[model samples]
Target: MSRSSTGDRGQTEPLAALVAVSVMALGLALYGGYLSDVLPGNSDRHVEGATQDRVWNEIQTNGVFDESTDIETVLVAGSTGSNEATDLPEGYNVYVAVTRVGDDGRTEVVDSHYFASDSSPAGDTPSDGVPDAANNATRPVPVRESPGDVEGGRLVVSVWT
Candidate 1:
């Protein structure tokens, strides 16, 4: 009869270790998947409808001064700006615009205020417009046909997340 060596006595250890390693790898993979479900996604989110209404109200109030909405003088000089629009919801972009409505049903953009976006420069505007703002709010307001002439107009405010 031949005697077995000490190394040969533990010959099955490598196979047992291989099985343990496989089980550990599987556990880690399952834990990673579970974390993905529990974590929030890293992408743009859809903004709430009420948020748009709140921003609209703010712009409508901003467009008027002294209980008058004849913003022609303010629009003409291109000096109208505000920090309030930029102080709204976090991770959102804001755009406020004033447009003139003609008797012929045509609309002309008279003024635009942009704020709180990646592309907005110095909290005023991006020049190209508010990025990622798909849904914008519109409301009727009094606009100046001229410096002193009152007429119909529209106020538009857009927000994006």
Candidate 2:
């Protein structure tokens, strides 16, 4: 008899819970599904940059493989080679292409190595990966031909999932 004044108190609890749950479900659906499409995925860019840095580091650790017969691994042993994939991330396909910078400021593909996630081979072009568009990083380096001979080159690393 004393608490009969506000009999709607019990009804408000369930109503409030239903509203809250509906709002949460709607938010989950929107954010989890549609929000990613609206947002530019920076993870791919970050991974591409990181992989580029790793390849450059490996090159520095164990120098670039030249076409000379007396090629040598400069710092680290068995890390960098001409036709092998380095310790890249498992889910990415990487394309490492080296270009010679000529005196006229042009570039020529000197050496290229592909690392595919599926353990397959990439085609003659870069568009053969899972994603046609890519996040790429390029760095200038020196190409060593023989003892006391060096030229300008650039390393281009392209990463795609």
Q: Number of the top candidate by lDDT?
A: 2
Clashes of 2: 0
Root-mean-square deviation per candidate: 11.8, 7.6
The runs of at least 3 residues in candidate 2 whose Cα sits more than 4 Å from the true structure, single-residue gaps closed, are 1-45, 61-86, 103-105, 119-132
In model 2, which range of ten residues has the least summed lDDT?
A: 69-78
Tens-digit lDDT string for candidate 1 (45-121): 43434544554444344354222332233332333363233334566666656777667788877666565544232
The whole-model lDDT of each prediction reads 0.56, 0.62
| Shift in Å, residue 9, candidate 2 | 42
lDDT of 1 at 55: 44
- Stretch of 10 with least lDDT, candidate 1: 70-79
The deviation in Å at residue 5 for candidate 1 is: 92
Error of 1 at 147 (Å): 7.1
User: Which segments of model 1 are wrong by more than 4 Å?
Assistant: 1-87, 102-106, 118-128, 131-133, 145-148
